[model samples]
Target: MNPTARQYDTVIVGGGPAGLTAALALTRYRHRTLVVESPEPPRNAASRGVHGLIGLEGATPDELRARAWEELGRYGLAERLDGRVEEITPLAEGGFDVATDHEDTIWARDVILATGVTDQYPDGVEGFAACWGRTVIHCPFCVGEENADRSWAWVADDPDHLGMTATAFRAWTGDAIAIAPPWLPGADELRRSLRERGSDLVLGEITRLHHTDGDLRAVELADGTVLERQTLLWPQPQRQVPLVERLAQDHALALNDGYVTVDEGRQTSIPGLYAAGDLTGKPWEQGVVPAVTAGSAAADAIHFATLT
Candidate 1:
């Protein structure tokens, strides 16, 4: 039982940065669009400000969204729904029908999956759970400046993550160390670079996190060795398959590395379907600009598709 409603030119899934950006473009292109978003906001604890972003640099996540909403409203081109999209089915005429967790359905000429991915942290670190997005994080560009020159540690349960995390951390601070099993990739390069940069690498498995006065203090290892550090960049395997799989199987869309496959114009495997943002497998540090650019590209493709 899908709830039927008025048909639209495009119905976007997940109204985060990408979806909203797409809506803005659609409006400018004179295409009707709607954005579906989850009520819960993105987790951003250690985030002082979104980095590498133009115009909106130093703006909090919520602030950026608010400004985007205002811009979208000015064009009367988009609307946001605080509900979950449960399903999407292809219609016969190069269009898609979407079903939501709420009792509602929407028909559209195109669909864009701007739904983001989830980052899963390592298990069994006591205070680590609470420190996520705050003192513990993954992307250095997103949280590096605030902890510069302070005590920092890189923890990874998986041994293979050392090289990549080490490289990303080096760009942020010269004083960083890796705490994980000894089986590190590019060990020679990492050790040489770390020593040259005055960083240390400790071999052990982190067992728990310690905090003082609600501030992250240090990480405790299995051998009961406590490394005193105010900030930690921990790496964990990321699982990003929910919405992309739904779109791929149900609508015959292409997927690349857990991201919806799209062409130069942002068209997906399914002709009219498009994707952008984290789900599109672009660099995660891309805050608003990339999302907006992808959305505009998709809008142009949609317009061309309708004309032909």
Candidate 2:
């Protein structure tokens, strides 16, 4: 069933840290906002603290969201709906009509895309999928502290990405190992860095992952040797949602490899549409800090819209 329009000044897509953060910012600016969030939870590792944000280091992601939600209530301008946004149409009145999976419509003067990205893990890696956000992770800053002093391994499906992952993991663990696939760049440098960092460099094809009840125990190579490790750190390739692709097609929204492009102010290519967080495509995906900053900037830009 489709929902009818409930008037709002801004409609934010996604309910994770990015979307939630943006909702808070919009309310603080006193803009009536509707945040449409799916019931599905993020698969990323649980965050202990939001890094790179001054004065909020070591604060859990949940804690940050809770605090922000409380502040947003003071402004009386935000509402949350537990449903997925199915589509968005630009209205003739210089606003947008956002349609949800439940058929609810939200009419807003502006739209904010806080929809995040998803990582596609390589295929045929047994037990690998189960270890995600647990012993296997993409962001070191998000999961490294918990893995401190544990035997860590960097597994690459392609040799080219080995050096990059290996170099990054060195800062976290001296016991780290780099396992490269065939044809990657800078092998000697990667090996040297591993040695200098007191880590190991294992170059070969990974045969399989040996685990006990989804807890990673070791990585089995083709040679039949098991490398003992408690955690695996690597990046996963991501793809954006089709709704964002349509957003770019209908509007002049700029996209870099399918991610919505935004300026320092977080405004999208289209007027009144803003983007932030993972959808904005920063190099490192700095977690909560990026989401919060982008959201605040988007709200500030929308405030300018009222003045103009």
Candidate 3:
């Protein structure tokens, strides 16, 4: 260990909603906490604003983060360090040593892994960059109600997913279109359900998207067929960040479907090591509100565990 390594009660990796929330709770409890955030933009950086969070509805991601940092500063128990965690080594002495890109080492009695996931968007799709988060959304509930009654399209990797997603989009609008790529699986039941829901199906591979100023106008197919749509629901897959993976592998933390496995209190399999937020492998808990709740819960658990 470095002779000058800073020590804290807890060291949290990642500064997204989960990490910041945990830091806030820890600080409020007067626990010495250190938050290490990467210089890179968060996964939700492309989104214009966050949804599903009351009192902060429509708040941009940047705004939410800025406000969170300000709140965390009030307690003076938590400090933010701008750097990426390169490695986390569990010390035999019962804490952990965290190494960062800034060449600084931090030792903490407990480590909280709040590193979020990364979204994988489709490649070679025109206008995707501009329309993403604005018109090209993933979860219908996230941006669906905001763009309700508009022409909506659901893009999925398979016929079953397309049918299911399109059917769900019907809650927001009646004019839902399922973009069924040519490679989609042939499922009569799914096709029937789509038709039963009055959702139109476009059978072709999307080659490009036509949009203006982040507002989607239409998607062009490989056959040059253009289907007009105002909003698109394309659920992108998510993967854990490198730091989470490294910690899981190095510490032998349990994982389920690539997400960290945590007990009800957000504690990982390893004692003194905890996890929170999206990395917890719960699909229904991927939103901002849930992330905040998970962080607070993890802090509470850690506090209680330390007392014993």
Candidate 4:
């Protein structure tokens, strides 16, 4: 069921860390906030732990969200709605009419968009999906520590960060190998850096992942050769949520380098429309803490803006 409020001071979409924290901050200011969360599992649901968040390290994603919900419950000003947003139509007069899959409509003076991005993985690789978040990981700061000191491979579909990313992993696993196609940019320079940094380089695409119950054992190359690897870092690209794409393309909300452009206040180009969390910044800026910080900052801006 949805909240009965016909109008709200602020309506937060996506009940992740960013949206929840935004609501929490708005509630402290005595504003009636509505939090609309999708029933779908979070983007990080497959991961085992929520790393890089201070004091809450190693906690599961669900655990972190549960704690956030528990704290949000204490604030009577915020109402939680369990449903996915279907559309957001901005009224010409002002504010917005938010529609949900449950067929409920809520009007709000301000909208905070906290929908995050979706990671795109490589296709046509056997067992790749099963090994994700286990042996096949993304950010090293999040999952590499536990899998360190074993046979490791840093494979990149794109070689833009090959030199920096591959060389930086020496501390975690000194014998890690950097793998990329031979024809990518800076290939020769990457080879020199890897050699200087005490690492090897492999030039081929991964064809298959050898694993058992998500524990990766080997990575097969297109050349039909298999290399025993306990951990793999295949840095892939990510895309914005459908809502974000729609707003950018249809409504002309500005985008900075493929992400929603926000000023210092975290409000989007559209007045009274704000965006936060992983959906608003570069891939490198994405993390639990950044999302929470962005949400809180956006709430502060909205509170002051609403006052006048």
- lDDT of the candidates, in the order given: 0.72, 0.74, 0.83, 0.84
Tens-digit lDDT string for candidate 4 (143-239): 7787888888888745656666556776688668878875778778777877887776778878899999989899899999899899988756788
Sort by lDDT, best first.
4, 3, 2, 1
Q: What TM value does model 1 have?
A: 0.85
Tens-place lDDT per residue, model 1, 181-295, is 6566666666666666566577777788898643688888889899888888764455554666766776667777756677988877776778877766644534456777787
Question: Which window of 10 residues has the lowest lDDT sum in candidate 2?
Answer: 42-51
- Which is the better candidate, 2 or 4, if ranked by TM-score? 4
lDDT of 2 by residue, 1-308 (tens): 12456888889887666777778767777778888866776533344456666776766766766676777777878887888787788766678778888876668888888888767777777787777766777778766786776778877655445545445665667676777765557677678766775665776666677777657789877667788887887677877776787777775568987678788778887777888788887537647767777877887888887997
Q: Whole-model lDDT for model 1 versus the true structure?
A: 0.72
What TM-score quantifies how close candidate 3 is to the native fold?
Answer: 0.93
lDDT of 3 at 83: 89
Q: For candidate 3, lDDT tens digit of each residue in 1-308?
A: 55688989999988888898899989888999999988998877887788878788999989998999989878888888988889888877788888889888688989999888887778888888888878888766677777888898887767656756555766788788788767667745666777876776767777899988988898998899988889988777888888777777777888888888889889888888888888885544587878889999999999888788
Candidate 4 overall lDDT versus native:
0.84
User: Candidate 2 — which residues are off by over 4 angstroms?
Assistant: 1-4, 43-67, 157-171, 185-197, 212-215, 249-252
Model 4 is weakest, by summed lDDT over 10 consecutive residues, at: 157-166
- Candidates 1 and 3 compared: the better one by TM-score is 3
Largest TM-score belongs to which candidate?
A: 3
